[model samples]
Target: MTAPEWIELQLQLPREQCELAEELLLALEASSVTLEDGADQPLLEPAIGERPLWDLVIVKGLFAGDVATAPIEAALAAELPRAPLQQRWVPLDNRDWSQEWKRYFEPIQCGQRLWICPSWMAPPQPDAVNLILDPGLAFGTGSHPTTHLCLRWLEQLPLTGATVIDYGCGSGILGIAALLLGAERVIAVDNDPLALTATADNADNNQIAPERIATYLPEHLPADSGADIVLANILAEPLIQLADTLVALLKPRGQLCLSGLLDSQLEAVTRPYQRAVAFQPPAIEQGWVQIAGTLRG
Candidate 1:
């Protein structure tokens, strides 16, 4: 089948001019806009206090194939008078948008026993524990190193009949994994409603009981009654801020697994919870760290 083509305008502009450039493109009826480093700088996910972009940025915008470029250039010239700009129009061939991710997101095995299988792919090991998850807008697919750290920790934990709280649960992957590994039930919490919905849908897709996984917004979460295991795979700043809240959700001598932090930020993230959690040496993967330990009474 033939792919649809869009006209993409690539604008090489100073980082400071990106904001005006994006606004101008959007106003010019560009369907979407994206940015890349014009100098070939390697970009990582932005973290607390981290710089996200390069000094020279290539701001690319996509428009309908028939859309005229004259107005776009005119708007750029008028709006960003002082900033130097280089622009080019290119044909952007769009492939099967629906199947694009499948090429990269195949089945992933986190640990010895757990296999994260995409819905369309059969589990490599029928006898092994398999999590049927399809990639979505929500995070966590056993892809990110942070998620891998958390999943591996969960896989190794003694979770049979244990209760778990998946703090900041993205796609419910961590919680669903706990259940698959014999957790009795799970409380999945996230700030985004879309994440909550995805978690619930994924839970159902995994054939977990409707009542086994409870989804809630942070404010809507039940009072912290505590659980045998608490898993939080969120950013370092939030982990530090929510240290007390998360600790309060841990039962006496309960286990806690924390990720979504860099090896550099590990000390700061562990400081708040240090007094309460008897943390073991952190596990590092691809510059990401997982801080896991038992909560003190």
Candidate 2:
């Protein structure tokens, strides 16, 4: 399909006003927004410290006409801390994004031995242990810091003949990595149907028989079932809420790796896991954090 012409509007709002900005952005997301790039391109700004401002990107088509733009502008002007200091509209033309996007992805090495390479990317030397992954919308392309950190931890952790459960298994990268690392069996769970399908496809790509890895929604897993390793790379709130249930999925002395969090959010989620697991300083990359811990007596 040909790419759509896009107008990129960059908005800078005060830090306290970011909430309103985010809400507005979500409203736009809910609507059918058009961007020069595919929907895969995220609009959220990279995490900035407690800065007093936030940058938001809104595609033009979503708010093209005067009627759409006026309401958004008026809403921001009314609810925002103050008038946005900056608002610029940049025109974007659709290009062959597939090739352009691939340029940003390459072989990613985790730990000393583990390597994650895109299927189209040349494999690393045979001597180096490699995990081949095909990038898709579902997440865990190994480019994300959290996924990289988890892959590194997986390399260091003992996985031979172990049962591993990947909670919120986006793209099934982590669980598949465990399988390639010698885990006997892997169970990948995700709430999204697309993620489940992607995970299954990725497993097949990695030569994992359907039986070797089981994919299910969280609601489908048996209550009593537990795993030797539990990995969750989801947001802070859900992580905290699922702490008891997640921990219960771990066998005594099992280990867990938690990501999709900021360093500041570490306490809220790790605190609950403290009863069964000892927390470790988070692994950080690109300003994102992933915490790890081992289940204790």
Candidate 3:
């Protein structure tokens, strides 16, 4: 059978004008809008209650195959700061999007002993420490370089009977991996309640006992709680901002692993904790940095 057609109107615009262009596209009845980095640039995460964009962004508006383009372009020209610096129309094949993601997200091995596998697929190596993950829009399927970096770190650690905290526990990926690799306890914490739910559900999916892993909103985690390891796979700014909070969760000489920052931001992110923690050299993958350290006894 032939696939239904679709139109992608792609425009390159400055960061300041990207939001306006997106609004204009939606106003023009585009089905969906996507924004991408136009120039190879350092990436930053959105701060709470704030939106950040690349210096140069490529915005693509998807429309029905038969939608008229001339009127949309006219509208953009009138409403935007200026005409898009570059523009083009690309043909698209409409497919069953529900199953489309499955094609690309197969089993991924982060280290010799660990694999992140979707629940529906067989593990690439059954005897390996396989994490059965079915992400529900929270985050962390091990595809992001930051997640991969963390997963590898978890795999190599001596986690038996360790108490671990997964701060910013998106989809509970890191925490669950810790449990599967033999950690005795994990405290999974996140600001988003949905993330906590995903974390709890994922832990259950892995056949973890309800008592083995605890999920919490940041405010609800006990102040006295301490762990042998704390993994914070959140962005750079949050890592810096939460330096004191993260440190307080560690036992004496406990390990602290952090990722989700670019290589350039490592020094700044580490400065807040450097005085008390002896950090190992950072692990780099795809330009993302992961730093692990031990709290001084």
Candidate of highest TM-score: 1
Which candidate has the top score in lDDT? 3
* Ranking of all predicted structures according to lDDT, beginning with the best and ending with the worst: 3, 1, 2
- Write model 1 residue lDDT over 1-297, tens digit each, in one string: 443467788999888888888888888888777788998887766662244788889998887776777977787788886645678988767753234437787888988999999998889998899999998878888888988889988898878999999998989999999999999999999998998999999999999998999999989888855789999999988999999999999988999999999989999999999999999999999899998999876
Lowest-scoring 10 consecutive residues by lDDT in candidate 3?
43-52
Put the candidates in TM-score order, highest first. 1, 3, 2
Compared with the true structure, all predictions reach lDDT values of 0.87, 0.75, 0.89
lDDT of 2 by residue, 1-297 (tens): 533444445565444555566666556542232223212344453532112222343332233322345556666677766675566554446543224457777898888878888887777766777778877778788887878878988999878999999998989999999998899998899888898999999989889978889988889987777899999988888889999889889898888899888877777878888888998877887767888888887
Please provide TM-scores, in order, for all candidate models, with all chains considered together.
0.76, 0.70, 0.73
Off by over 4 Å in 2: 1-98
lDDT of 3 by residue, 1-297 (tens): 553477789999999899889988888987778888899887764432235688999999888777788988888888997888899988777763234447878888988899999999989899998999975668889988889999998999989999999999989999999999999999999999998999999989999998999998999999899999999999889999999999999999999999989888999999999987899999998788999999988
Comparing 1 with 3 on TM-score, the higher-scoring candidate is 1
Cα TM-score of candidate 2: 0.70
